[model samples]
Target chain A: GQQVQQSPASLVLQEGENAELQCNFSSTATQLQWFYQSPGGSLVSLLSNPSGTKHTGRLTSTTVTKERRSSLHISSSQTTDSGTYLCAPFNVGDNSKLIWGLGTSLVVNP
Target chain B: EAAVTQSPRNKVTVTGGNVTLSCRQTNSHNYMYWYRQDTGHGLRLIHYSYGAGNLQIGDVPDGYKATRTTQEDFFLLLELASPSQTSLYFCASSGTGVEQYFGPGTRLTVL
Candidate 1:
């Protein structure tokens, strides 16, 4: 089965610093999604980038399908940004086949 | 935006007990999925359905059974729950396998 591997399983950063999370999948995909989960909360979709760069708020998602990887960049991080970030890549025709990453646990200091 | 809702956001059951989790999607999405979330396991798919009356086993389907009674409803069953079955569960729906939206989630504890 295909799997998603994320770098820096856990991270701690200062409030004003920037954070970059990486996601690498084991399969080819046409679309990939980035999700955020606050402590003890539900998953929230951050972005759905096809193959290039996408921006939402201070978050930027860049997907390179040919490389089977994507990255989520968080700029000017805040304590409220503390949470887990996950990524999933799926075949467009069969989104149900997507693989999920364990996620990058981020903690921002006040 | 997609709306996925789960009932009884929390549950508790004893070993060998029976449990059921319910999910409803109003977006008329054809793809629905049930997943369990553990500390390190991330999210493991337990089952999924493409439409009403359709069921597909997911990667982690050993102790779970699911039903899709209508286009808007899906349910997961645990006939004999165990301690290992305790985890946070999420229900999601996709309009076409893309941009999946999730329900708040249900925390189940099998004591």
Candidate 2:
């Protein structure tokens, strides 16, 4: 079974500050994806990075597949960015086996 | 827009009761999955299907059954529920990619 562990189970940040979250997975996979759960509890996929670094807006995802590690960086955070960030190692080759991390909760203070 | 929708956003049942959670994905994705989220457990997969009529067991499948009757419809069933089963359930859909979209989620409470 694959195990995914996220660092800094919870965090608090000042608005406009930068935040970093880490995710480590136990097994190799085709891609490492990130999901965000809002304070209102809606879950949405944020990014899917297989390797190297990818950025979307103020968020960036870096994945080292060989190292089984991925990181998410949120720059210039805002109050609306407060939420839980989750990671999962997914294997498209295998149907029914995506391992999810416990997630890192982020709170952006005003 | 592509979306995944779940029925009975909240459910309350008693021990030994029968319950069904329904999911429908308009994304037309081939893969649909069921997961339960708890305080410490994070998210545990209950079952998943690659397509219509195809079912696969996941990490936590005990006391749960799932069916995929159509490409857009997937269902999770609990013939006899327990208090331990009280948790937030999520339904997700994805195509051949690793990226998945989740539903609004269902909160089930068994007394």
lDDT top scorer: 2
**Candidate 1 segments whose C-alpha is farther than 4 A from its true place:** A92-95
Every model's DockQ: 0.77, 0.75
lDDT, residue B85, model 2: 97
Interface DockQ of candidate 2: 0.75
Candidate 2 chain A TM is 0.95
State the lDDT at B75 in candidate 1.
100
- Clashing residue pairs for model 2: none
- Candidate 2 lDDT, tens digit per residue, B1-111? 779999999999999999999999999899999999998999898999999999999889999999999999999999999999999999999886468889999999999
Q: Per-residue lDDT of A15-85 in model 1, one digit per residue for the tens? A: 99999999998878877889899987779988898698999899998888889889999999999999999
**Which of the CAPRI classes, incorrect, acceptable, medium or high, describes model 1?**
medium
Model 1 residue A34 CA deviation in Å: 0.5
TM-score of chain B of 1: 0.98
- Give the residue spans of candidate 2 off by over 4 A: A92-96
Instruction: Estimate, for each residue in A4-52, the C-alpha lDDT of model 2 and write its tens digit.
Output: 9999999999999999999998888888889999988899999889899
Clashing pairs in 1: none
